[model samples]
Target: MALPTASLLAPGRVVPPAPLPAAEVARAAAPFGQSTMLPRGAYQDDQVLAWEREHLLDGWVCVGRSTEIAPKGMRAESIGRSGVLLVRDADGALRAFENACRHRGHELLPCGGSSQGTRAIVCPYHAWSYRHDGSMIGAPGFREVPGFDTSLYSLKPVRVEEWHGWVFVDTSGQAPDFGSHIGQLESVVERYDADALVTPVVHEYDVEANWKVIIENYQECYHCPSIHPELCRVSPPDSGDNIELEGNWIGGNMDLRTSAATMSLDGHTEGTVMARLDEVESRTVMYVAVMPNLLISLHPDYIMSHLLTPISPDRTRIRCSWAFPAEVVEREGFDPSYAVDFWDLTNRQDWAACEAVQRGMKTPSYEPGPLAPSEDGVYHFTQLMARAYQGQQA
Candidate 1:
């Protein structure tokens, strides 16, 4: 039977999805294999994102690599709606502050912008000047004001810390201590000597999907054989083991095919293996997701990172960078095209899948699904998120 043109041409309407229910939240936190996916509202609701911005991500979010800002350099970053300023002082110490000037709330540096060799942070609005350490230095037409103390007007401080060459900022002052937050990840990756490595390539992606969707994609290889043919050729889809750890993180490793050398397009590398890697470490790739916003992939010859910035309910911005040992990067005729191209292609594939999921979730018939045994990593992460929601409700 042929459908009428008028019926086909009519616009279809969809009712807005409801908020997450307590029952579903409990179901998502249930034991692995028994648990189902998080409720659709977790990904589709603006209110859920607002709660996450204030609780889950406001504290100890990874902003960028420490190497990006040189001595006397300053960069502006954002955590949800709040702005942050990262500074490398004259003494080479790293610091962070609220991006606003102490005088009139004007941003010292534009978001997503960087300044090098800066001597002072001067406000464009009122000419308030601050030193590299965030101490007030100059205040035009204010020194003589009654009881106006320069000491009391320094830029607001934000807790900053560095771990394995990555910079993290805590705006809420309520996150667990940095050490406890990092937990056993330090001992797990210490052999890589990540602090001594240098980043040589970075790529940004604006994905039309919830941040959690992208993370769920990274945690499991269930889709690798279908979407990432190149990756599957270099590493078996089933050759993975999830690690149990004590921290606000989740991770595991996958063994490389004996025929493969590294995770490049051709499964080979001209780069030298990291000096501290043992035999097993040299042949495996480790994937780690630090809570909130950082994803770290440790390879034998290089390290790759993905920093997530949630833009809206269905949008995220990702910063992906590749880091290699200094000696390997400085080698004559050294080229990183192999690694960069491989991941760039893989990343696009993942983004496409995440976008599809986002679109599907909006359909009226969409329902939460069960997790496969291979999806334990995803299950672990969802459990954490579900528990967080439960705690907030309580």
Candidate 2:
């Protein structure tokens, strides 16, 4: 079925945002070497989070890998205040729709729920059904109405785009085109051939920290020597350069120690190196934080991703996954624990630190602090967020 225009499904109402405190804006706008972190209220206040949900989180937000939903399968996601349903038709085409049923607006699938072999999306409230492509198929007891027409009540469509293997959705339907949003990052990751990779391990964490806190943590490694001993042992904490690229993302690469082969507990890997990586890529790990919600780490042997879902002002849900080449996963006695266990430990340590920051944000004496010289990525992200708070684009 052809999708309906975004206008058909009313655009999200744009509410005027409360202005940020002058001091906060000034702090965020400071030069990198002189800049400080965003104010505590930015991380701890409900109104600040509401502004973010309306502004920063409106664009292309990553939900998960496209591989998670199979043909004739459906997965539900919560994007800002809207619930979206991702469906894979029998023909293998991926589609998305507002999760609500046409009648009474009951949710077709609860957020975070998934169903396999879903031939029809049947609403539990009244059994109204929709095809995989979101066209209305049946509406019980509605045909008797004076002018009831099934064609006029098809489920509303939401914009969904799949880049490589990752699935992104635009709930607001008002953001820039997906290609524009992804920008030059495409050329950078093209060599990875991520679409051909398979994720063998997935970990979920309920972190008691603001979403930005977790992202800021991912963007810097100044704390690696202190918090992530294992990670620091495998990759040098000070050996990397931040790339000034043309994309809606920020990141750089950290060289792996010569003695280490990959990011594993033993600093070695049985897996084969990815096919297209150059010599530099083979020796360094690239960490890219896609604006707002996704973190991508590219290693010689595999790829790791973190998808962030902001639960509230001070809570975020993180889904972490590790992907390896299909051939590597199919090898005899193939085991992912080498990569998984290493990251699981590293991830928990990072989460603990983030939680500490969240708690610290509540302290009455807490205030924005200076960015270290090594925290260039953090400074860039902070500036972008500050512009967002002031209703300006970076």
Candidate 3:
């Protein structure tokens, strides 16, 4: 057989169906403050989605919680155009592999389910089985076939990592070390004891907007005073500041009001402060962005996470979860209703704003706008997107 071309193996290398004009491309490559949005087509075009799936989404994404796939558990998720399987082996180690059969390219495991004590992964089509480590275990009958080697046909593997009980997978298998990239985050968040926290509340929303709109809304609070009255009452809009990092992460801090102990509806904590936090730490809210898909907000009493998933050019899914100390949640009569209710209202407000922006972008008069001084985080995010879409690794 003839050798495959580089373009065949790396889809990102192929020319985009609808490429951005040269002038717009140059604008995107400029510094954060100097950069502006890509053309409106970049947000509503199918060709742009195809290019993004290959270059951006293939890098790394936070899929689910570690507890969801404990030892001997198996789950599947859609990454880009391919389905990926996440499995915890009998040894309690997590691994990710492509979810296709070696023989006929049929889907091996279903999208969501427990392995049910399955010893080996058997393909439903041809009964080809693979071990937990992705080694070929058995094939019914192939002894007479020429040049057939079971050793060469083991299942393909993807990169998976666990951080603070959250599971992340890299489809391209080229992502940098997770810890090395965001290790500085521990200095600011170690006091929160995130490892001891358990997520008990989750909110799912399907917004009619591009994924970038959601991320931009999150990185800046310039609209908080106008949109989120309750949020500004606690963490004032002007009280926030961000620090750009060298790795695939961004860090920032916002000071809560003097009388506020937490981010509840009334700016008070009904429970005790989080473990190990000093006086100042207890009154501040920290924001961290783990590039490509994860955003984390740490409070003195709890932690909140936003996972952005793109469904199409103009549709995105937002998964938000709130986690508190395991002991706090286990206590009887403990209600987090205040915090939940406060954020619930605030989230819907932001989602509405994003949807409105999406609708505006479809108009013929839409044009890229300049960034405000306080919207530094949005600028950084735009820079990252521009780099990735232009075939540069982020």
Candidate 4:
């Protein structure tokens, strides 16, 4: 059925979908963000899939959680729409795989790779085996088979790394190295030193909305003033001059209500957290939502790590973690929940917005609308998605 669009469109926004003469794909998308917004399902189109496979998947995908996996071959899954295995090697290095067995691709078949310890991954169906490094190690009666080259069936390895104790995995292998890509975000990361940290509380949610809607919710604070009363109390969204956003999110900054010079991972509300950021938790708060699925949020007393996973074009899963300085976590009377109220509340507001949009998009008027100049970050995301589909994969 032709979904309605008039209801979602702004006052005099998108008209009916009149087909346009073909032009360059980038130029075609120009109208979506510039003269008009994209039509409904732009987020769900097959062409968009083609673009993501080339640009996004080829880019870095975050797969980081340091303390979740134990020292002895621990395994954890970041179920962000996709099930990615976060595995720690026997030697402590973190590795991620597609969480499958070569024999009929079952996720449950394993003997040595179990809850306690993992010496090897044993498949139940055909007994195929793989090493921690993602190499295939065993295959039943392979020596007697004619075309049995076990070397060809290695477990596909995804690029993985740890930053401030957070483990990150990239399925696209095309993303710059974790260290290099993070270099662009050094100011916030260097301030937090999250790679060496540990999370005390983990939070996850399944919301009724598209993943893009959730991302747009995270990127801007324009709605903070009216919706998040507590957030406005502690850190007014209008006062977002605290942390400056670079690249696509330029001009915007952390809108902490205080005039503190900087914030750190530990949530300290004073000092030059951005300077000499090697070790001190001098500043009080910081936030960064990396492309695709990860958000790095820092507060004075703790840190909130978010992983945005898409269950489908319309549904999303948000994974959150609360990490603190190990000593503080070990201390008695340490309450991470005290710091969580602000984010938890803010997230609720965002969720409401996401649901509203999802419901509104079902109306026909939502197609090809206008852009609010203040929404540069969100608009940029749409543009990037469109541009990614413009060319053949480079």
* Number of the top-ranking candidate, with TM-score as the measure: 2
Better candidate by lDDT, 1 or 2: 1
- Candidate 3 overall Cα lDDT vs. reference? 0.76
lDDT of 2 by residue, 61-86 (tens): 89999999999999999887789999
Tell me each candidate's RMSD, in Å, in order.
9.4, 5.2, 6.0, 8.3
lDDT of 4 at 80: 29
Cα error, residue 1 of model 1, in Å, equals 53
Task: Highest lDDT: give the candidate number.
Answer: 1
Ranking by TM-score: 2, 1, 3, 4
Pairs in steric clash, model 3: none
Worst 10 residues of 1 by lDDT: 1-10
Predict model 4's lDDT versus the native.
0.57
Task: List lDDT for all candidates, in order.
Answer: 0.86, 0.85, 0.76, 0.57
Residue range 1-394, candidate 1, lDDT tens digits: 1111111000232212234698998888788878899999999999988877766677788999999889999999988669999999888899999999987799998999999999998887888999998899979988688988889888899999989899999887766688877778888889999989989999999999999999899999999988999999999989978887666788899999999888988799968889999998899999999888999999999999999999998999999999999999999999998899999999999999999999999999998999998998898788767866765321
Q: What's the TM-score of every candidate structure? A: 0.94, 0.95, 0.87, 0.76
Query: How good is model 2 by TM-score?
Result: 0.95
Stretches of candidate 4 above 4 Å error? 1-38, 44-55, 74-84, 108-116, 141-152, 241-252, 259-284, 392-394
